[model samples]
Target chain A: DVKVTQSSRYLVKRTGEKVFLECVQDMDHENMFWYRQDPGLGLRLIYFSYDVKMKEKGDIPEGYSVSREKKERFSLILESASTNQTSMYLCATPGAGGSYGYTFGSGTRLTVV
Target chain B: SQQGEEDPQALSIQEGENATMNCSYKTSINNLQWYRQNSGRGLVHLILIRSNEREKHSGRLRVTLDTSKKSSSLLITASRAADTASYFCAPESGSQGNLIFGKGTKLSVKP
Candidate 1:
């Protein structure tokens, strides 16, 4: 089965600290996405990359940035963590074939205190 | 602002009963998809319904699409406790193929 592995399952960081969330997909998919899931607002895309070194902002991109130095890995960065940034972060990729469906990482729940 | 807005923000049902969730989208779409997320976990793709297809089924899950209404529904027959999760819909529009989601329907199947 295809897998998207997240570097951390849970994290706690102090406000104003720089934080990094990592995701690695076994499939060599060119497309990858990062989203933050909240209680009622649902999942909002922060950024997505269709190729290495290429990225685009989604609906909500404020306070977040991404890195795609490699094809199989994508990373999300918080310039300076804030209390409002505490949420579950999910990394996703299209299925084996692009656009058929999606495979998502287990998610990293970040808590900025 | 997002496509595929779901209603009935929450639902409660018994183990042997069926659970139905609805999603509606605006503008044209290439396809629509449904997903399930367990508590504090990433989403799992449940089913996908293309624009031309009216209905599709997989295992105990049935999905229907009405492009004219720009809406879709997901029915889970004989839902189990394990089926309790948050269900979301994503409507893909344009060639970008990026997904946008609204508040999901949280289903709780009681034993």
Candidate 2:
């Protein structure tokens, strides 16, 4: 089975602190994505990377950034954590042209205090 | 902006009953997918219906898409207690390789 592993399941960070969430997929997928899910708001994309070292901002990329330094790993960074940033962060990888469904990582619930 | 919205924020049913959820999107899409997510876990892909296809089925799950209406529906027949989870509908929009997910409908199946 394909696996998408997230570095943390739960995290707490102070305001203004920098945070990192890691995701790795073993499927050699070319596309990786980061999303933040909130109650009543659904999952909003923060960023996505289609290839190694290439990234693009999604709808809600205000305070978040992404890095795809390796083909199998994608990282989401919170430059300055804030209370509003508290939410469930999900990572997913999709096959080329979305021919197959995405494989998601166990989300990380972040609480910014 | 959110591309999709799911109707009926929550639903409850007895085991062996059927459950249905609806999703509507604002933009054109290449495909619509249904996913199941247990509490605090990653989402499991259930089914995907292409824009050109009207309906698709897998096991007891049925998915229908109406491109003209920009809507989709998921139906699970003879739902089991294990079917209790949050169901989300996502649309593959643009070429950015990201899925736009709906808020999800929480389903509870009691034995």
Candidate 3:
């Protein structure tokens, strides 16, 4: 079975503090994505990387940034956390072609207080 | 704004019954995928149907796509209590490889 792992399942950070969320996939997929899931909004893509050092902004990329230094790892960063940024963060990896579905991590629930 | 919207935000059904959730999208799509998420966890892929295809099925899950209408429906037959979860539909557009998701439908299965 393919596995996607997140560094943390729950996190709490002070407002204005820098926050980092890590994701790793054992499948070595070429595509990785970052998304924030809210109660009524579902999941909105923040950023995605198709390859190492190559990233693209998604629908909601204003307050978040991402890093993909390795093929199996992707990281999401919050330059300065805010109360509004508190939500469930999810990371996913897609198989080589567009034919297969994505495998997602367990997700990180972040609280900005 | 969300590219897709799911109807009947919530549904309650008894075990051994069928549950249907609908999703409507705003634009053309290469493919539409359905996923299920348990409480406080990540999503699990359910099925995917291309724009050229009309229907697809996996296990007890059946998915139907209507490109002309830009809508899709997911039906879970003889659902069990374990099937209680949130269901979301995502549309993949063009070659960007990014999926635009719907708000999702929360289903509650009563035993």
Query: How many residue pairs collide in each prediction?
Result: 0, 0, 0
CAPRI-style class, candidate 2: medium
Q: Over the full model, what C-alpha lDDT does candidate 3 score relative to the true structure?
A: 0.91
Lowest summed lDDT across 10 adjacent residues in model 2 chain A is found at A94-103
Steric clash pairs (candidate 1): none
TM-score of each: 0.97, 0.94, 0.95
Across residues A1-113, which tens digit of lDDT does each residue of candidate 1 receive?
67999999999999999999999999788999999998878899999999999999998899999999999999999999999999999999988753358889999999999
**How well is each residue in A15-54 modelled by candidate 2, as lDDT tens digits?**
9999999999998888898988888787888999889999
> By lDDT, who's the top model here?
1
* Model 1 lDDT per residue over B2-47, tens place: 4789978999999999999999998888889999999989999989
Rank candidates, TM-score, best first: 1, 3, 2
RMSD of 3: 1.5
lDDT of 3 by residue, A12-40 (tens): 99999999999999987888999999998
Q: Of the candidates numbered 1 and 2, which has the greater lDDT value? A: 1
lDDT score, residue B29, model 3? 89
Q: Which residue segments of model 2 deviate by more than 4 Å?
A: A96-99
lDDT of 2 by residue, B36-82 (tens): 99998888888888888999999999999999999999999999999
**Higher-ranked by lDDT: 1 or 3:** 1
Q: Give the TM-score of candidate 3.
A: 0.95
